[model samples]
Target: MAMFVHLTSAANAPRIRRSGIRAVGHGQGGARGVYCFPVLPSYTHTHQWLRELARFGSRGGLVAVHMRLDDTQEVLVGRYSDRARGAQSIVSASEAVRRIAALEDPRGWEVFVPRAIRPREVHRVRTAPQVAGWRYLPDAHGVRPCTCDGCRVRGGYGSRRLRERLPHPLDGPPPPVKVLLARVEAGDPGDPVALREALHWFGMRRRGPLSRLSRLAHHPDPGVREALVWAVGRWSTPGVAELLDGLAGDPDPDVREAVEVVRDPE
Candidate 1:
């Protein structure tokens, strides 16, 4: 068997011990599965996901669920960053274990099992140190992070502190929906950067009159068209759905991709 460790909220320990870990995906691409690290010989490396998982764990303290899989079981493996971008490869469980174990530094490697781990496959569930691993990424301690609107999370833990320390060019509280609407309505149609920034604010606020952004649905710039999809997709106002449906088959691949993400923002 190839051993694996899954870090999850401790509040889920009881249910996990009873029914095993359910498959769920995170990040933009929405690849649903059970994410885990192969149980390496180094104890610290084996539990490397503790801290990162805790940031998103709403149930408080976390627990490590040690599990096992048949050596030949197929699973997806890739760099932690690659998984978010939908880049990964299918390999046998033993192969994944062997590959990571051979790496002198396997800090960012991740494995995903597409199905639920059966109760029998769960070896043990134990509480994990809440601060055992890195946040953002490994060796990212002193690096200055990008504070751009797209790079920074709005309501993430410690986000306020980060914003105070490293303000972005476009950083600040979001403006009223009406103000954003005026920016879009009065802004230059040909300047994609300005148009997209206005649309980005609309998406962040997740509110606005859909008709205000209707003109950009067929914008010449792909980025502007993509921004339009994101901004309008966040609203549930009538007509918004119909407008998105129209862009569902946009000529630009990026615009079409944005439509898929907006429609299935899991």
Candidate 2:
């Protein structure tokens, strides 16, 4: 889970350090382990440095490569559990090198290039609002949102199924009709009812055929007209392109915006 790198300006320090290296490990309770490296004079060659580390043994401890991704570096742990039997093929540093080098291959995950690690630092902070529109849920969903506090609360499940329904477009099947029927029936030309209906239909039978409802794109109501643009965007029907293109120049700004949203989601 942790990686440590040593850097020194001396050209021959690594070579001198590598000559008398030893593999050490813990004994019983909370004992320490140490391992030395056979370094070479100035790792001017990358492959040589990698080979030296590959040959260095770790006795029976874990071996891993610390990889760097965008803003984080990952420690990929190797699997090596046995030590007492001297099972030569069970684990080796060469295996770790092969895994680490594989990371650089295009077919494999990319390797971590060397970079400086920033020092750990701390800063003060404060809390802020967690989510948007949670306070207005009762008004939005036409039902009370959960208001139970942690203290003195009771919980129970209701077996009853609350089947609230909403209106469907005249060209299609009925949907879960809602109390907003009155508003939808009498709302202005820019009302969002038709868009809401299309969204409902889109959510319900997404796999159903669309050839029959294609005519709804020419509905007299701008809301219905705009909804058709959005529906075509959602369904991605090639036949509705002409209708959406016409609505792109609708006099109503809302309808025009809907047209644009459908035409260019970017």
Candidate 3:
């Protein structure tokens, strides 16, 4: 699922382009498509740009607007299988506008990126050197972090199963479990897929049987803490109660609620 911003009018291009790009939840169904544009890289720039994007969406003008979150759920890598690719280069916003507007099917997934949109790969090279930590992510295919929309959206540790019993007499989390935990524990906090799946593993007691992840209860992201709350019941040890006690004071209401609901579902 690549990001596609439909220029409402030719005039909106320059203003929208000033807002830098980042992917959050969005889709094209309700005009909620991702609207990342060419802009200077700075924290303040993103903060201001988001305001502009939302403002344009309100008036329903040529400026960047919102899209349905559901439509942009799946992020895919490489050329999309079903949708046709946009032109190699669209010289002017007018041409891009004409081409997309002239499309045989305006409701399709095709996107027209007008200029050199820097790839996400550039950030990884500069910020994160190769480390053993990345091995846990589901994308075993390659080393570099995949920027494909599909790859981005693929979360939850790949399995929903509660647990898989160990085969040998030795008592240690199998390598696979270790990797899953690594992915959940060390993964991008913004993406919580693996963290969710890892919680399920813990909920099944495979976590205790294999290993314990004490740090999970204190994960900085509230989403991870909530998942841990739901899984606390599965800790076959006395620590479950203590963990729940600690979580009762959690800052996020959602996390506290998960603890309460999971503790006493009746």
TM-score against truth, every candidate? 0.63, 0.27, 0.31
CA error at residue 137 for candidate 2, angstroms: 17
How do all the candidates rank in terms of TM-score, highest first? 1, 3, 2
TM-score of 2: 0.27
- Candidate 3 ranges with C-alpha deviation above 4 Å: 1-175, 187-191, 206-211
lDDT of 1 by residue, 1-266 (tens): 99999887777788888988776555326645688899887888888877766554336577888999999998898887787667888899999999999998988789988787899999999877786777668897899886666556656778778877876767555667777767777755657887888787777654567776788987789899998888878676789888989899899987887787666432
Model 3, span 106-182: residue lDDT tens: 32223333222233311211111111111223234466433221232222342222112322222223346566666
Clashing pairs for predicted structure model 2, backbone only = 18-38, 165-176, 165-177, 165-178, 166-176, 166-177, 166-178, 167-177
Clash tally, candidates in order: 0, 8, 13
Please list the Cα RMSD from the true structure of every candidate, rounded to 1 decimal place: 6.6, 25.3, 18.2
Best by TM-score: 1
Assess candidate 1 and give its lDDT: 0.78
